[model samples]
Target: MDLNWVPAADRPDLVAEPVRPALRDDVRVAEIDPALADTAEFCERYGMPLDTSANCVIVAAKRGGEVRYAACMVLATSRADVNGVVRRHLEARKASFAPMDQATSLTGMEYGGITPLGLPAGWPILVDAAVIERSEVVVGSGLRRSKLLLPGKALAELPGAEVLPLAQ
Candidate 1:
């Protein structure tokens, strides 16, 4: 829990290429062991609570033969309601987790390190209401070796971000 947090903009190398330009002054970064990047392991190893961590998942939503990608952020202790709320919100006939390769390739981030920040301009970022209620939360830094810390409200303020009851 005693992470050496620093301004994300000051340590661009710690974040993904796409996330660099989007780093807000309030966003902080902390380097960590890549082996423990996954939520459970990272929380356990760092003595952090699961509720203080957020998971960003890439969803592929399709309607009328067009596939639109979106980022959904939820508390580590909650599950994204992909098949219900998300599908309805996106107005997509079908919605499902994006393939790992597609997610990483499109986001220009590592598989386990995709964050809502720096996603493609048109992609919608769905933030769970619970996540926005937290004072601070740990999210991916676009690299498995690091993590980003920021106020929950910061995520709600991101471009194209929509605050909703996205958690199940």
Candidate 2:
């Protein structure tokens, strides 16, 4: 994709505040048009395939008057099994996408740019098996104006991350 990849740690401004401390040496960041931050537009504009992009979706799960939030990482071409696999995995009676305001505020990241890297402590990060098998993948940098590129294995190594067949 011809991106000028730079160490994410060296470009703190390119990532969200919470993401800064989680940045690993293997992660790279590249600037992009904020308008193209969405998966479809970003991949098409960069001539990248859908399989090379990953999306991190925030899910809100509830059980016995308690709500737990999780981040699900799925390939751009796949859909997260939120109602099925996720609900069961989280042991929550109900699971749904987190509201934009809550997601952004809790993650300390922009709505469309939330990434699993810097999620709050104790939040389960369910990573689709397909995503972790890839050698490299593009993901949000916690900011709409840039993107993060790293080996798929890196995602699986994040704190609270769990590799699972969570995509359908």
Candidate 3:
């Protein structure tokens, strides 16, 4: 009931300039205990429904000695279709979650706080269609000690984002 969301503008590095303005006016940011940053913990501690929380995971795949990176967003109720839909879409033979080192370093976000917003350009974002239907969803704030909440449709409109049935 109390998400404690403040203005997202206060967190500059955590939110990219381009991505921030594109988000809706109702989007909010809030400080959270780093320990509760993960989906289950955050939902349990904050009294938010698990179904309304989304996980944005970075994935890696290789093809012909070249590596491709992608971010897949799925609701906590479901897992990302990594090896199936994601692999096929990336056109890679095998796809798996990116290492913590790579994911955090590339996105400039904490391991447990990576969000779909502020991802490196050229990286494709595959959002589960179901996740976009929620009126409000809680995601990471680029820091384990904070979280961001916004309309699910706002994420659907991000640059290079594809709203697909990407969860199983």
Candidate 4:
């Protein structure tokens, strides 16, 4: 799909208040096949030397026979260390990655194309602090074959995202 045809406001609602700058001026957006959204392939295809890209992962924790959804935003440079940081913060005995089947089914986003922008409500987004410093970074566009490049700070403010010192 050509994002150029979609007006900024008409774009899918992000989790955060819609505060996008003119995307073309501050960052770049690329539309590639869904296959390229995979971490290894995205980096290789884009010739990105670093993995500072934001990885949107869905996590599930059982809350009294019900499951809660959360979004984990880790720097591709590091891991979420869910057991160490995320679980502790959530006060849960265990926090696990949602199965690919469940995540895709719930988020309506392809497995590799999940971006923090359009996650389900009540899903807390945890962001690694280091990502805040990057002038520009690539992240999923709620669809396969498309990626958004923009100032890191703009991403940090996405709805429900809590910028925390969660990275190594």
Candidate 5:
């Protein structure tokens, strides 16, 4: 099957790194016949090394302008304190988790399949610096039940991915 490619223009805020074309070969994409809601189990069953994977979570915040969404990218080994770190980082008067529906709708990726790779341009992507410390990691491939295994360095290179100290 031909890969479902999301063009760069559509993901204005998602930073694409200058990676070797070989990266496409290392990462695999699979379509979930029936979408699964649990991200942890899906990663384990797919032989995804969670220790090196960056888990992406979408948090909603209203910072001066219209309500905006920010993608928090943290390593599987660590967690981003949404209320503490992410909330402050965004400097929103009110911050909360975006409902699965809204998150999925705003981002073209499934709830359990959302990644920082192809998110909406306006959505801010804040990545935990520790994620870049790892040599390799698995990330969502824009679909439920599918994953992308690639070098951690590649993820940090994505545009607008600010490496922050966000592990708790």
Candidate 6:
């Protein structure tokens, strides 16, 4: 499938140190109208199903006085078990969504465009089991104007990924 992926390396936001090497060979990216960055709108505009787009959410909590971040990828149709499955997985006493500024700064990606492909090491990349069952899925491209389409199984194999029943 010609996903119309331009070189992900071309984007300055994703091409820097510690970021470029993290994107895998199998991942591909494409530009979209910025207005379509949201999953539902993007799906409708692109003729993709809502279920085939995965949302990467950042969840955080403090443990031992250090804040830990986990990237949770769940299908647009479902929601991440943030406080339940995720908090337990991270061993967090309490967990909630990471603030927008923190998420953007830490991942070096736009607010609506973080993906699991190039997240920082040591941060858990939690994948919902259902997402991997698909042959390909759409995810963010590190910018509001683009999206990534890659094999769902490939996402499950990222360095820090843990595939589980992460969606509720």
lDDT of 5: 0.67
Candidate of highest lDDT: 1
* Whole-model lDDT per candidate: 0.95, 0.94, 0.85, 0.68, 0.67, 0.83
Instruction: Write candidate 2's Cα lDDT for 1-168 as tens digits.
Output: 456789998889999998988999999999888988999999989888999999999999999999999999999999999999999999999999999999999999997799998899999999999999999999998999899999999999999999999988
Better of 2 and 4 by TM-score: 2
Writing each residue's lDDT as its tens digit, candidate 1 over 84-151 gives 99999999999999999999999999988999999999999999999999999999999999999999
lDDT of 5 by residue, 1-168 (tens): 222334323332222231122134334444433244255665555555567668889889877776878998888878888888888888887778789999888876666767787677766788888887877766776665445656777667776778888889
Candidate 4, residue 91: CA error in Å?
1.8
lDDT of 3 by residue, 1-168 (tens): 356677687665445343464445677888777888899999999888899899999999888888999999999999998999999999998899999999988887788999888788889999999989999888887788778888999888888899999989
Identify the superior model by TM-score, candidate 2 or candidate 3: 2
Q: What is the lDDT, from 0 to 100, of the residue 166 in candidate 2?
A: 90
- Look at candidate 6 and tell me the lDDT of residue 108: 83
Query: If both were scored by TM-score, which would come out higher, candidate 3 or candidate 4?
Result: 3
- Per-candidate total of colliding backbone pairs: 0, 0, 0, 3, 2, 0
Candidate with better lDDT, 1 vs 6:
1
Off by over 4 Å in 2: none
Better of 3 and 5 by lDDT: 3
Q: Which stretches of candidate 5 lie over 4 Å from their true place?
A: 1-37
Tell me the alpha-carbon RMSD of every candidate: 1.1, 1.1, 2.3, 4.7, 6.4, 2.7
